[model samples]
Target: MTQRFMRATGRLRIIFGPAHSSSLDHEMTEENQRLLKQRQAEAQQWETIRRPDGSTYVVPKNPEDKSLR
Candidate 1:
């Protein structure tokens, strides 16, 4: 399966002279990467199964996880 990860380049602003815009952009990029990693980790713990009704459901591979819907 293809992995879905965000390619966030962060927000850029018009740097006229001296400003902390680059730092702010870097923060945003870091946040995006963190979230992307979190999602990938969650996906790894789940497995996709198709029901008899032709609907797909994501269930955790770890049977101990009682978060099944």
Candidate 2:
């Protein structure tokens, strides 16, 4: 029997399944690990500010509200 699994990104869907081997499982694991690393690297490239309360926010390159400045 084959099973299907879907990864969701908001309204977007990524489907990969029906895999039937240990090799397939290993491949999927590697792919997920690679994607996670890529996302971590991308996040590190962005600017973020940490609050004293332990919350964090991404610093916008442009401010939409002029009064904020």
Candidate 3:
């Protein structure tokens, strides 16, 4: 077919597909893993305490209350 003849009959086409996401959670480095573990250890030290007045308080299980600062 001639180029001009083909161009006169050609129609546009559109294709769609599912959306995708790329995640970096699986790409942790050794230093990132170590820091995550350390932070988890520190978070484990938090405690929820109840008082005689029925008030609630959150404090570190350790003597130092870092959250207060």
Candidate 4:
């Protein structure tokens, strides 16, 4: 029996079958890494506000002048 290995999302995965594990894993890993990095960058760019009541909310970059109810 032969065991195939694949890499996805910066992680290694093992597959057993006729599937091309190496190519598939490389592609998956690249795409997953790209998406993860993108998300991380976006998260860092956003500003979050935490309320004293243990609630958290995202602060809008632009706020309209409105009276608070």
| TM-score versus the correct structure, for each prediction | 0.45, 0.33, 0.41, 0.41
lDDT of 2 at 51: 96
Whose lDDT is higher: candidate 2's or candidate 4's? 2
What TM-score should be assigned to candidate 2? Answer: 0.33
> Residue by residue across 7-69, what tens digits does model 1's lDDT show?
222222233332233233345568888998888877788999999999999878997876422
What lDDT does model 2 reach? 0.56
Model number with the top lDDT: 3
lDDT of 4 by residue, 1-69 (tens): 234222332233333434443433445568888998878765655578899999999864435522221
Candidate 2 per-residue lDDT over residues 1-69, each given as its tens digit:
222332233233324433343444444568888998888765555578899999999865445534323
> Which RMSD does model 2 reach against the true structure?
11.8
**Top model by TM-score, which number?**
1
lDDT (C-alpha) at residue 34 in model 2: 90
Model 1 gets an lDDT of 0.61
Task: In model 4, state the lDDT of residue 45.
Answer: 52
Badly placed stretches (over 4 Å) of model 4 are 1-28, 60-69
Clashes of each: 0, 0, 0, 1
Clashes of 3: 0
Q: What lDDT is reached at residue 68 by model 3?
A: 31
